[model samples]
Target: MPIPLPSLDDHDFDDLVGEARALLPVLLPEWTDHNPGDPGIVLVELLAWLTEMQLYQVDQLPQSHTLNFLRLLGGPQWSPPDTGGLDAAVRQSVAALHERHRAATADDYEYLVRTTWPEQPQAAGLPRVRRVRCVAGRNLAGTDPAAAAPAHVSVVVLPEPGGTADTHPLPTEALTTALREFLDPRRILTIRHHVVGPEYVDLVVSADLALYEDAVPTDALADARNRLREFYDPFAGGDTRDGWSFGQSVYLSEVYAVLEQSPLVDYIENVRLTRTGTDDGTDADGIALDAHQLVRLTRVDLVGYDSYGRTHPSTWELPA
Candidate 1:
């Protein structure tokens, strides 16, 4: 008996092609004229069209060559064990197609290079710095006096750098340097640092200071603290906290000192002292604990230097 074929609706196929075009433009901007009227181009386009439709069943191919071409493209998702003899035949056809087209597409070499080159960094200056507390909770330990005590600091900076032209490059560079530092066998603990960019400078830096696991004799901790104090003290002090509070607020202040010294941060702004709390029975004994906190660093209406020298407010919602 002859095999019955699977057919796709014309309108459904068109819709799938349209979706692929829309998605491809954003990621593959150079492939603007992908649908030229050539037999090979048509075959490739049809394969993409089928993929967009989520039609992975191989028996649906209108021609054996179509199945072979898809397999040659390394589309293992479409090739199943049940495909039997069809798989071997497709592979042979695909090998022939490659031999024929290999020389013709050699001229496309330049286009390929241009498309793959990394994007240029966006111009941005240093970022405004702020610090929040890393409160303790279930992740750290059971109820202890220090569990209630704030252990490590949560450094917050703003405006949150999205992969914009300005901030992305700096963070990329900073992340690289940080990873290198982290892998150093001589280094016992991971040192924390912020890579901040200003609206002015196009490049980002490491901001030179490190948050040490233990106090070091060198300038790393001292410089970091001094830089943070200069940026944080003005807004963090005073009515932000009433009467005497556990020196936990000071933890952010110390973190600010580190950021201030960082070469990456251009300046500090909209600095505010916010509180983080936790009810995880394990706290107060200086034992490590995991906790969540609210951060308020930037405000919507304000720009540089508020009435009290606060820069602007940008807040973040972190998971508990």
Candidate 2:
């Protein structure tokens, strides 16, 4: 007969904690709890408890830190050994717990950009759009749209080739140089680069900026937008047609951005901007500009992908 695994909700966390507390004194004699609420003290107790559970479950003794204990508990890259010393088993269990927690806490952001400008009927004939995919790494990437950190920001742009324009090749060396120049400590402008391809040019960047709360200022935001405009201006100039232009703007600040049919020049448009502080005055969605009124935008329907991979309208505010 096989034993069924218990669901997380079904596990008795309180009983597990109690059993670990009872064994802690035997394992770590020097450890003391002067203040139970202390963060450090709490962490130590938690580790001690987790280690005890590992020992009980595997019927083994730990030789080192609790990491091995976790690895044995079905963590990534861990497999049950035919036989092992008590220490090895304990270490494995600890490692397994760490891996599980890490994966659960990891965050990911994804956005899709699409063509929103209506297709025009030309006498000479409309240019054929090619679809190409190019992935380039970003440099000096910040967690925010505006790269704020001195050396921690990087971005990767994926260009779709063949729909409206030819794919522009983004070289690694060019990106590194651009990052270096964009991140010049003296300049307020944070430079970000993207590669556009066959039918549409889209810029996608991401960074883990720790100082996100203090970095997003009005000046920084303006500079970031301007730099993006300059980065894509050359491509825009080459593909100028009466009704045909760059797609709508989509920016992800702090987390993600999704824009539809943005003017080639409007890099900061349709931003779902977020700030990391306690100020409620900040808007989650940045200032909205009417695409038709502000930029003579031609509304062409587009398809967008949700986090779950379902397709929907590309418009930011969908019709009721």
Candidate 3:
């Protein structure tokens, strides 16, 4: 909806005349007669009529003025036939202006990164941006995660999968360059933005899947592994099933829920989400991820469940 324009002068003729009469005792105390027939009242009404007419003209913007404003927006000329009306055209033009053309806020930077990625000259053969997260006041291009850089903004982006074994995809240097070029022009002059790939915290998860009454052991194991993979998938995995949130910790309970959503598994037990390069993931039940880190499910050990909830290896396989 178009923002309603404020009235320059909201007083009508009657309102102006009433206001002038109300001020008669204060402005001219000696001449206290405010009757309609008084000569002083007649003069005041006449002046009020002229002032109201001037206000009306000032408040009403001409069609040419709207056209000039449209021109100042620097897009194609607005046509009544295409937009249905001037008001709608102005609203759409303003909406587009704020959507991707200007990067005045942290949101604008991230919004532009996704909205303008395919349009960049360098994006000719690059993969689509699957996810984007913006962190203001952090310089992610460097190694220091604790440095305070007030005027800086960092954007972590993940590319769409192109049928690769690498489950976690990173934004290529070309992709980052293209994003920088697209956002640099739209960003505010005082702020600096850095385009970078996502940081992945490698993980090795192991879980026992209890098969349902009709579930095949081999097939169920594969399905269970696949579910776990997609549950932490960079493009479409997380608690909300939309994509994992940045800095989100991986909890053992969430893993259980993701696995249990499948019909092949009756129950899950003894889940271990051990972080790579460490003896155990931050703790026994959770893996702590940095603000810019996402889980890279490098490997998962799937097996049949035992009555005692201990390790039970069965004839299960990951699809080749």
Candidate 4:
């Protein structure tokens, strides 16, 4: 809805004349010509008309004038996202008119993180923050059992397209620190913000695959491994290439479906899914990630077979 415009003048001509007449008794009591035809009354009406014209002119001033006034008062200016062939300054003015700087809600916080950085160059290394979940809860970190978890906002960031495995593949410390500083001013002063990665669920697949007689077993295994890796990839996982949604659970049925869809495989048999460690990781059959957690494929180990047939055995330890 559009904001309603206010009238330029507080009083109409008649009211202005009446106000002037009301002051006559105090300032000039001896002058008693109060009739509309009197020269004094005509002068008053002319002055009122000039005052009304001045007020109307003030009201008709361009919005740019108002913006200039605000700039003088130290108000921040907005630069709109570039969309070619359009006037960026005009677009920026429109966007700035609608913008609210406060981060009182989850969506608000997310918007601030995405758009409110002071410098664009510094943000190049910052991970594309995929999802943000805010909650008023206690910390559930098993390692830091006594850690306090005040009202916190957890942000999940998508990793870069290609990065080494050992180091963090997403935003570096500098980027995160910059984000922290950027968001600190906009965020609700009390709530804490945390940039965290998805809880990785390592998969150790012990599958008996029935490959086509013409297909090399090693090649088939590699193909199957690649399929699983793609299916569980953080950036391009799930049914669609888009990154997995936060809290999306991993189901064993989906894994089987991907394996069965492989063109090189005749059939998959004796497939067992097992979690790696017991710290809320993947379990047998599937994983039930929490609202702020997501499943990421950490490792893929194909056991019990070589190019010929099943030769070695692999073991998994279940959490007690």
Those runs of model 2 whose alpha carbons end farther than 4 Å from true positions after fitting are 1-61, 64-68, 73-76, 79-229, 233-320
Please give the TM-score that candidate 3 achieves against the real structure: 0.71
RMSD of each: 26.9, 26.0, 6.3, 7.8
Model 1, range 214-285, lDDT digits (tens) per residue?
Answer: 323233333433433233222233335321111322333433444555553444443333223333312232
Q: Which digits, one per residue and each the tens of the lDDT, describe model 4 over residues 1-320?
A: 75777776666677788899999999999989999899999999999988877777866757566556545543565333357323454556566667867778767766666566434566765655544444334343334423556676655444453435422244556656766666677777787776544454455555766666577666777788778877766667778966566667777688779888877777766666655575444466677766555565555555434446754333332222
- Please provide TM-scores, in order, for all candidate models, with all chains considered together: 0.15, 0.17, 0.71, 0.62
Model 3 sits at a Cα RMSD from the real structure of: 6.3
lDDT (C-alpha, whole model) for all candidates: 0.34, 0.33, 0.79, 0.62
Instruction: Score residue 38 of candidate 3 by CA lDDT.
Output: 95
Measured by lDDT, the strongest candidate is: 3
> Evaluated with TM-score, which candidate comes out highest?
3
Measured with C-alpha atoms, the lDDT of residue 5 in candidate 1 is 64
Ordered by TM-score, highest first, the candidates read: 3, 4, 2, 1
- Models ranked on lDDT: 3, 4, 1, 2
123 in model 4: Cα distance from truth in Å?
3.1
